[model samples]
Target: MKTTSIRELKHDTTAVMAMVANGESVEIRRRNVPVAVISPIPAKSPIERPNFRGRLKEIYGDALLTVTGTDLISEDRGDR
Candidate 1:
């Protein structure tokens, strides 16, 4: 890790970026205290699921639930 004043960062941004690419952290100072740190962004791991789709299909059946419109009306009770 290294520290640099804001003025130094503004003067030579290319050098600062080079340091980050080299896997070294650079701390930017405002007056005499550290204000921000710069480092290379970490890469994300690739996801691997061999049977993801099959597992989902097995969990939830491939069917849609439906009800006939007439089922909402009450059945006639006069015959009782």
Candidate 2:
């Protein structure tokens, strides 16, 4: 990690970007205090494919078809 003032970052943006691309972390300071950090992009982990139909069948089975919702609220007839 390298500390760089905000002024230097503003003056040479390309150099800072290059450093970041080369796996170097950059610390930007403001008013003589550390403010921000620029680092390399993180890699994402691969996602596993889900068996939707099989999972649903295993979890719900025949109950999925028999389940029903009953409306309990009555409509209020108001005058226009």
Best by TM-score: 1
Candidate 2 lDDT, tens digit per residue, 1-80?
A: 98899999999999999999898999999987999999999867889899998998899886645333332222233332
State every prediction's TM-score relative to the real structure.
0.57, 0.53
Report backbone clashes per prediction. Answer: 0, 0
Q: lDDT of each model, Cα atoms only?
A: 0.84, 0.84
In model 2, where is the ten-residue run with the lowest total lDDT? 71-80
lDDT of 2 at 52: 97
Off-target runs (Cα >4 Å) in candidate 1 are 49-80
Q: In angstroms, give how far residue 18 of model 1 lies from its true place.
A: 0.5
After TM-score superposition, the amount by which residue 2's alpha carbon in candidate 2 deviates from its true location, in angstroms, is 0.6
Q: Candidate 2: lDDT over CA atoms? A: 0.84
> Residue-wise lDDT of candidate 1 within 1-80, one digit each (tens)?
89888999999999999999998899999999989999888877998759977987888679554754554443433334
| Range of the 10 consecutive residues with the lowest summed lDDT in candidate 1 | 71-80
